[model samples]
Target: MLAFLYPGLGHVYLREWLRALVWFFLNVTSFTLLMPADAVPETFGWSELVAAAENVTPEAALALAAITVFSMIDAYWMAKRQNTETEVEEGTTCPNCGRDVDSDLEFCHWCTERLNPESDEAEETADDSGANA
Candidate 1:
């Protein structure tokens, strides 16, 4: 909810100070840089605030909205990652085709290539002997 309202607030709540600062600065900078010169009032007040909001360009608004969305996504994912019990290990790759394969499997699932380490060494030895012959 905080992220929805004030992008990156969720990161602050989660004690991710650096991420929160980065996201908040990005959102604020996008809004400030993209906003039209005439959009902002000379003085700060309720009426001026309303006028500024009214005068904001569609591009600036869209950019800020996109930043807000990214901030929320980052916050959500950071929190989710923090809460996760364990990190998933990367899967082993098939030597024949360089495709990821299950650790328990002995062959490349995608290419049907043999993946046994001992067999691969034996084949290498046989090839070396044949070459010598």
Candidate 2:
């Protein structure tokens, strides 16, 4: 939505400073290179803007529109990805060190504690069965 107004505004909302700047500069450069000199207005007004827009060549309009649309889509996807990442549970706590650790490993990465979850479950099951026998 914000990107519909300009290419970099959506990136700014996403807190991507670098991308925002890049997109902003790209928009300025495109306008500088593609916009007709006669289209530049000395005064600022809604009517002046409309008149200027009328002078934009079809090719330039297409390019600028494409950039804005792409920027909006990119920002939308990034926001969606951020939301998904935050919603998902991540990693595990190391029991020994009480620190965050990767869940893929069988040991606490920080304290080198054995946290072989599968083996521990198996052992517990075996112990319970044996005790019942």
RMSD of each: 10.3, 7.9
Q: Tens-digit lDDT track for model 2 on 16-130?
A: 8998998899889998998898688779999998898788899998888888888899889888988887753544777677787777888987889877567889999999999
Model 1: per-residue Cα lDDT at residue 92:
75
Candidate 1 residues 1-133, lDDT tens each? Answer: 6888998899999999998899889888887789898897999999999998999998888888888888889888988888884544454777777877887887888999877778779989999999999
Report residue 103 deviation for candidate 2 (angstroms): 16
Candidate 2 to native Cα RMSD, angstroms: 7.9
For each candidate, give its TM-score against the true structure. Answer: 0.56, 0.62
Report the Cα lDDT for residue 6, model 1.
90
> Ten-residue segment with the worst summed lDDT in candidate 2?
86-95
Q: List where candidate 2 sits over 4 angstroms from the true fold.
A: 88-133
Residue 82, candidate 2: how far off, in angstroms? Answer: 1.0
Candidate 2 TM-score, C-alpha based: 0.62
Per-candidate clashes, comma-separated = 0, 0
Q: Model 1, residue 49: displacement in angstroms? A: 3.4
